[model samples]
Target: MIQLLFILLMIQIAFILILSFANPLRKLVVKGLDLLKQGRGPLVTKTVAATMCVVLSSTVYTITKIQKRSKDAGIVNPTDEVLMARRLLEAAFLGFSLFLGLVIDRQHYYIREINLLRKNMETAKKTKSQRLLKEMSGN
Candidate 1:
């Protein structure tokens, strides 16, 4: 579980880095993301995210239960201490991965919007230039 979470976090970080720059790879990554958002891709992504949330919740619940038991006994056993630490690590990784996923999504969306606006601006410039040339020649 720890390994999986670590790998996911790394992948998300790399993806964000790729999206942060203006490069050929960024275009490719954005195009790939566009395809991923189409069809059943979104459904699968949401399902996986939901599953991670459920698991994270369960880990937190377990940690609380362990803490309560220790408080009632007035002492923490070694086994319970180790288990609690592991659960905490898992929760932290899960939370971070989820948050980064959201950030990546938002960044991708804004990049797409920026590209669209740039295209529109260029088209308008060209049209205006053509109209000015016609007016100047007619006058």
Candidate 2:
């Protein structure tokens, strides 16, 4: 269990590092989530969060009861290993959900920025063309 937790933590750290950088993989991930989020992003996020909460609480409760029973039977629950495992798993899921939310928000911001840039470019082009036409007619 400890080994599994260590491996999971390592993977999570690596993932966060990768996300911190500006890379094609990050862009792809953000773009994919953005596509999925189109109109129902909030609903999806909320649903996932609620589900995680339910699962985490239930798992914790079960582990705690098992540990208590084992202690009553004059045995240690392996240093609370099961509880630790459950909490670690819950943390991982929460972290992933948070990362997903942040990515979706960033993608939305990028999309808005792109649209704004396009509009500005089009306006500039139109004005330049109008100015050129006026100059030609003036001549």
Candidate 3:
């Protein structure tokens, strides 16, 4: 369990590092979530679903390879400790993927909803302006 938690912590740190960078991936994840909250197009919302997968797989592979290289290494996961850690990583990645998929599915719908809200706000502003103009003219 501790090992799994450590793995998760490492993965979380990597994610944080990625987010801290001023890169396209960071923008995509942050901006995508924003658009999603604004009810933008689901298609436009490219959630980082694939990201966790690629990261987790590569990380697990590297870790496993490292463990295999040491001849002094006793039995790896012989008592399910490593297996449990693997399961934790797997669960975290799988759950993240599903959640992103669901959220991104509404990407297009969100876009349309945001557009409608903008249109409404603009119309309201124009109507208020026209009303003010009429009042001034009458005075």
Candidate 4:
């Protein structure tokens, strides 16, 4: 029953996370993973950097937690199990935060790029039409 409760809690947490990050974050994850497989570009590079930072920061935070726990428990040192669980939870949250940030940032970049592309395309079409009109008048 306890295990089931934990699972339900985790599911609820995950749902909230997904809901909170439903916009660009979700899109960023899919795009970043795809970019990773393709193995190129600034998007993938940023994602990889963000991911590494998340992992390292989470490790540091978890170690600090373990240190605090050991001091509180007065056990001189904590067991591997306790420390590992603490670290895992810290890492999970950090990773999620990083992922969410990346997604939002990536989404913004995508929107900007799209806007620029559209503007360029519109300008090109207008110029081409003008050129055609000039040629028609000449004839």
Report the lDDT tens digits of candidate 2 across residue range 44-80: 8779668766765676676677667777888666656
Q: What lDDT does model 4 reach?
A: 0.63
lDDT of 4 by residue, 1-139 (tens): 2354346446545534543455656555555544644646666667766766866686987777777777788766537566667667655655555555565455556655776899999999999999999999999
What's the residue-level lDDT of 120 in candidate 1?
Answer: 100
TM-score, one value per model: 0.97, 0.49, 0.36, 0.43
Candidate lDDT (C-alpha), each: 0.97, 0.66, 0.59, 0.63
- Cα deviation at 95, candidate 2, in Å, is 2.3
Question: Which candidate ranks first by lDDT, i.e. highest?
Answer: 1
Estimate, for each residue in 1-139, the C-alpha lDDT of model 1 and write its tens digit. Answer: 9999999999999999999988789999999999999999999999999999999999999999999999999988999999999999999999999999999999999999999999999999999999999999999
Weakest 10 consecutive residues of candidate 3 by summed lDDT: 40-49
**Which ranges of candidate 3 are over 4 A from the true structure?**
1-80, 103-114
Candidate 2 local Cα displacement, residue 29, angstroms: 7.6
- Per-residue lDDT of model 3, residues 1-139, tens digit only: 4465456556655545555456677656656556655754544434444655566676677556656644346654454556556655665655554554554445434544766899999999999999999999999
Q: How accurate is candidate 3 locally (lDDT)?
A: 0.59
TM-score: model 1 vs. ground truth: 0.97
All predictions: root-mean-square deviation over Cα?
0.7, 5.8, 10.3, 11.6
> What TM-score does candidate 4 get on C-alpha atoms?
0.43
